[model samples]
Target chain A: MPVTSSRPVCILGLGLIGGSLLRRLAGERPAFGYNRSTATVNAAVADGYDASSDLPQTLTRAAETDAVIVLATPVTVLGPIVDAVVEHAPDCLLTDVVSVKEQVARIVAHHHPDARYVGGHPMAGTAHSGWAATDPSLFENAMWMVTTHDDTEADDWLAVADIARAAGSYVVPAAEDAHDRAAAAISHNPHVTAAVTAAVGAGESRLPLRLAAGSFRDGTRVAGTAPELQRAMLEANSVALLNTLSETIDRLVAARDRLRDHGDVAALIEAGHRARTAYEEVAAGEVEPIVGVTIGDDGWAQELRRQAHLARVWVG
Target chain B: MPVTSSRPVCILGLGLIGGSLLRRLAGERPAFGYNRSTATVNAAVADGYDASSDLPQTLTRAAETDAVIVLATPVTVLGPIVDAVVEHAPDCLLTDVVSVKEQVARIVAHHHPDARYVGGHPMAGTAHSGWAATDPSLFENAMWMVTTHDDTEADDWLAVADIARAAGSYVVPAAEDAHDRAAAAISHNPHVTAAVTAAVGAGESRLPLRLAAGSFRDGTRVAGTAPELQRAMLEANSVALLNTLSETIDRLVAARDRLRDHGDVAALIEAGHRARTAYEEVAAGEVEPIVGVTIGDDGWAQELRRQAHLARVWVG
Candidate 1:
């Protein structure tokens, strides 16, 4: 059975993720959203979405119904939203669509200690952002990380996982810090790497730029992401990002030295090919599934995390 | 006017590039190709194109007609092929589709110094290789590097440039050394970086593997290229590859250090975003074209190289 509650979902900040979620879940549940921009709110309302520019009023409505609240704002502007949540909807089950988990979890724990919170990050996005780019099917088949904390409640975890499923994603349960580290490896560090590659390709001459083809274009694609938005997530996960970035630099530098000294890049290219093959196998769904763990058993969070570490998902 | 050469083109090694070129240029100008594999030759001949496995006979035929001999084999195999060209077609205007121009230029200079030669590198490929993977339109609108050495003949250069245009590409006039350096900056170094990124993403745990998305996917797409082919090109351009790799490493290390020391990746991210914007503008064809230069004048090669340095194309 799907672990779900009938409580309404209140989405804070109707940007891409929030607006999409509201669109997907609006008719199914008593879902509503808040955006700071009146123009966006009016547009959403005109499109028959229950959206408003009033933050406190939206939070109060969510609190009155004991709703599940999703924070879909950028990490930079999250503090004030959390503050508003604390003042008006302290009893709500909290979750987020933030890129980094530990920072948001820390903020929740610091600002509203008694709030029932489970951090979430749906691994989906396009190069575009804002409400205009929002799509209802943004999270289809995407991995939504529902994080586990020492103080995480079973019911709260189930609530957020239900939201993730409703948004059309598989749930990958992880601890807050582990989520950040894995994200650094997969997302944050890749951003920095892409940025560096793009900057280097755009060097002192136009020749490299003219000669660049598929590899350069694809490798440096994410470097086109908004600088401030990238900085926010990258800086928020600095510790893990720093470690991952250093590891990447080490690998690149070693490859360089090998090429300089031995005139061969076979080892690095071979290893990378093997890794890419591994990814292809998983992506093709050729790998057998790991055994599943029940939600809310003794040591269930740890067991779920272990299974997730093994690349298993709980599509609850 | 389109530079036209009625000379037949003989391609040695019917791999992806050669096979595609043969398919494209077969009827336009008398074109035939030779592959070591009998199956590939049979397949091409069955498709109603002139292809053969007999290298000596092919070169001898080309010798009688004074055809342009395009050395389309890998760099490692070029020495013997150049020797064959010297033996059978010493007076033929020679060229190659090699990835690195300087190495092929050096080989031609050593083996057939009196042979009129220009090196060409077409910036096009799929991950797949071999005759089956060949597509007739691979070079459509692609940039094809036509290299100039101190002894490069105007008519010889025009012959290769004509072939590139006939195969549907924009001609980029560059000196052999400059082509290798530009290629290292755009292609070879990007391959190494992708390999490192893929290897790093596939660390000890499967979490990163499962979490890999579009950025990681595109960033490491070239890591999936056949290892031997990548090694051939990367190793051949070791000097330029080493320099570009070191520059990338330095930039990544600085980004890492900044993230560690001051919690700021703004400079790097900002610079990268600006560079990506520049690429976008150029890719969108918003950049103005440089003034065209005449093909055979005093310092014409130097003038064409200068225009190419400003991201101009000769499309002749």
Candidate 2:
């Protein structure tokens, strides 16, 4: 069953993530927002979001009434935010929208013994940030990855899911450590690699960069990702990031070595082609109604009849 | 002045590049195509491109009449083809459309004293290859990098430019070594890095790949590069590739270290953000109509009048 509560969700920090959530769920579900910057809070209020800059007042109101409160601040500020929430809003189910999970989970666990906490990360963002860039449909078709600490009750899980679902996101279950490792492989290392590639083009002449239109531009596009947010992710998941980058460097070295020795790079390219093809196949399969079949007027008809016994078949 | 030769060109190997060129130029410029496989040659003929399987006969026709001959084959087969062309079509202005420059230039130089050779590479291709996938507008707005060896007459330069122009490509002047180095840094290394990144994702489960839709997908999209062509490029420029790859590893290591030791990744990310912004700005500038200026009522108009004095200015 879905979490049903009359209490509004209290969103801390009205940046991109928080503002997007507020925009997505303001009318359907009541949301109160708090941000460190008073200007941003005022802007959010002006834009029709219920917002306040006073932390204690907001936390007091949330603790007294809200079903869940979302902390959408950077990782560095999370410890103090969690502590403050624990002291002031101990009754509400607390969750966070940080990129790194294990450290965030540890923070919640350390500030535990009162209110429960669930890890919630909606995997949707752009290179642009701030409240003005917020879109109500930002989370549509996005994966809202979640992890649960010991104190996370079933009701608490449902409450987080309700928030994500209200924003049109599908909740994906994840173990904290596994999530970090996967994210390092998929996100952090790719960002660093893209940055390195982009830096190669950032030289004296603008000709190469000008000529870098198609594959090079698309391939290294993520090098423009928001600096602070990326910094938070990479530093927070340092161990995993290091491991992923190391493995990738090793793979690149091997390809380079093979090219050096045999004067052949087909093996590496072929391997890449296989992986890319698999991803394409899977993505294509998601859209296809049916793949690879032959229908005849024989035993296949009997099998079809058996499968479709509940419905009448019409001859076309 | 443009090379105004009316000589019909010979295109060896009716694959992706050759077929695309033929399709683009056949209506205006005459082209005679040759391929090793009879099926491909027949397919080319069926598609309205003049082609045949007999190498000597086609080469003889091109040598007797045409001003330019384009060897559109794989790198491994380039050596024998150039040798054959030297023995058979010695007077024609020889050229080949290959990804690698230095090695192909070396091959042309070694088979010398007979036919002139100009290195031509139109940086336009897809993962798909062969005659069926050929598009007439394949090289439109693409950079056709070229290098000329000895015996490259005024007629030879224009002949090559004629073919490139016919395919709607602009000729980019490049020295063989500089071209190789720049291509290694921009094209070859990026391909290998993307391949490695894509391979990192090709594991047991499809979950990570499923979640890899945004930056991960965009960053590694070039992993689908044609295996043989990309392999030719990476292997041919292995020395440059290795140097580029090593430097990238160093940058990535530094980023990883920053994240690990100081818990700071902002510097690296900020550098990346700056580079990305510059590229975006340059790309945006390509389309914009003279940005960043203020036209004051009095002094600015007088300054503009003064600047426009060297040339005639039409009033809007």
Candidate 3:
């Protein structure tokens, strides 16, 4: 069943994604956004957003109106955000935008069973982070993976899809393990490879490296990525990441051995060529889009607009 | 000592680099330029270049002038070019613009000891090849590695540097072995890796790769490289290239192991970050410029111009 009430949407942890969501909603409806960082909240307000730094106050405001509360905190903070949301807004449908689905699902299941929680991970980011990098188009053409288990309510899944659509993503339903494995293969493994390549090259004389041309720059450019976040993700999904990393290493080592022993380097080169082509194919969306869903008329949009208006009262 | 008369500058194989050299010398002096392909000479003439398809005609032109003959053909064609130059313009300083140095040096030693051949490799190119990509700035700010053996004279080395300087590169002297090893580590190995990475990514079914963000595109963009030329370089310098490939694989495997074993991924991430920084340092020339000597005097420039003019006319 679709959400019948015009509940204002309350977004918790207004960082890059949350702030961007608030900005997008502000354009179409009144939305309440809260961040632990006072400066972040202030910056959002300065940008004319309905945001607050106080979690309890924000949650109270969300409960008074028919609003869905989205937890946009890091994985470490997700549990606390859930507890706070449940305590303050028991009547609200709760969801999260964390990358890991299993952890969020378990937390929601154990603590917020009656609070209508759904788990979502939007596959989008920029080199830049924080509220400054938040843009509505960030989610455009991005995949929003929403994972549900056997205990997940049918209505809650639909509501999660609705939110993802509103955020401008193609909502794809996947199990937790599948999502984690796929992400490990594509995102995490590549990032690690980039880092390793950079490290090895850097170990060379710093002077010669300075003269590195376009190819070196492009191959190792991602090495400058945020280490903490990458570490966290790697640690969180170590099992799947380990498998993908091992597979990549095996391929590279085999190629190296072939070249060393004067064995056929053609097959090795061909494998790399094939891998790059496959990656390009997926990136170009030449394959089917991951998420498939059709909008149910404009009813959800109208309700979202009504909720946005009520949420505006808490903005000031 | 400088040549008593202007050295004749003969260019063997009037393709991109050869034709460009001929064209640049058009109004100033005529230089002998030969091409195996009759169509190339015709195209050069159409483009106002003084060139010929006949080796004897080009050789006769070189004999009349104090010229240096540059072999700008592929590695496989360099031996024949050296033979032609040696048989015709025995006194002319013979040089080449091939990427590999050791093979060129060996051929020169065996077949053209009296021809004063200096091995040259300009570290500059575009995705596009042929006469169309031949700009005078092709060697600007680029490294031109000049390899000389015990048999090569100081005068011949200086002349090779002069030609490279005129072509807009900073000339750096290296032994044939050093040049080959450096080229394999920086250029040839990277191409193979890029091709393999692209092939792998392209083989994926996740059509999300089709949306291959900027990083993927940038990383695998070189996969479309000319396979024939790449294969030749790999085969020619297989020993050094294999060594570098082994090193790269070792680093990649180490990183994978770290991630798999739940060891510190931080070290791996840091390595990548450092590599990128080192690359930037080299590209910015903050590190010492690798190749050519700085021609700080207008006298040297004028002398080069005068010699280039005489060589061009003799060849024409």
Which prediction has the highest DockQ against the true structure? 1
lDDT of 3 by residue, B1-316 (tens): 4642245577887655666666655454445577888777787778777778888778877777767778888777777777777777777667888877887778777887665677887777654567666676666666666664444466776777777766666655556776676677666666766665554444223433432354455656555555565666677787777777777777767766776665557777776766665565556533243222223333433333233222110010
How good is chain A of candidate 1, measured by TM-score?
0.94
TM-score of each: 0.95, 0.82, 0.76
Report the number of the highest-lDDT candidate.
1
User: What proportion of true contacts does candidate 1 retain?
Assistant: 0.76
Question: Where is model 3 chain B poorest over a 10-residue stretch in terms of lDDT?
Answer: B307-316
What lDDT tens digits, residue by residue, belong to model 3 across residues A218-281? 7666666567766766667777767766776677677767767774467656556556655544
Candidate 1's residue-wise lDDT over A1-316, tens digit each?
A: 2445456999998887899999989888899999999999998998899999999999999999878899988888888998999899888889999989889988888888887888899888766678888899998888888887545678788889899888888888888888888888788887887888888788666877887888888888888888887898799999988888888888887788788778898889998898888888767784333355566777778878888888888865
Identify the superior model by lDDT, candidate 2 or candidate 3: 2
Q: Per-residue CA lDDT of candidate 2, range A1-316, in tens?
A: 3466454899988788888988888888768888989889888888888999888889998877764889898888887887888778887888887888898888777876555777888877877788888888888867676663333455676677678777887555555775677677767777877778877656545545544556677767888878877877788898888787777777767766776678777777888788787767754553211112123323433332232221111111
Candidate 1 local accuracy as lDDT? 0.85
Judged by whole-model lDDT over C-alpha atoms, candidate 2 comes out at: 0.71
| lDDT (Cα, 0-100) at A277 in candidate 1 | 84
lDDT tens per residue, model 2, B1-316:
2455355778988788888988887867677888999999888888777889998888888878854888899888887888788777887888888878888877877775555777788877766788888888888867676563333454565567567767787555455665676677667777877777777765435545544556777777888767777776677777877788777777767776776678677766787788788778765653222122233223433332232222111111
Model 3 residue A49 distance off true place after TM-score fit, in angstroms: 4.3
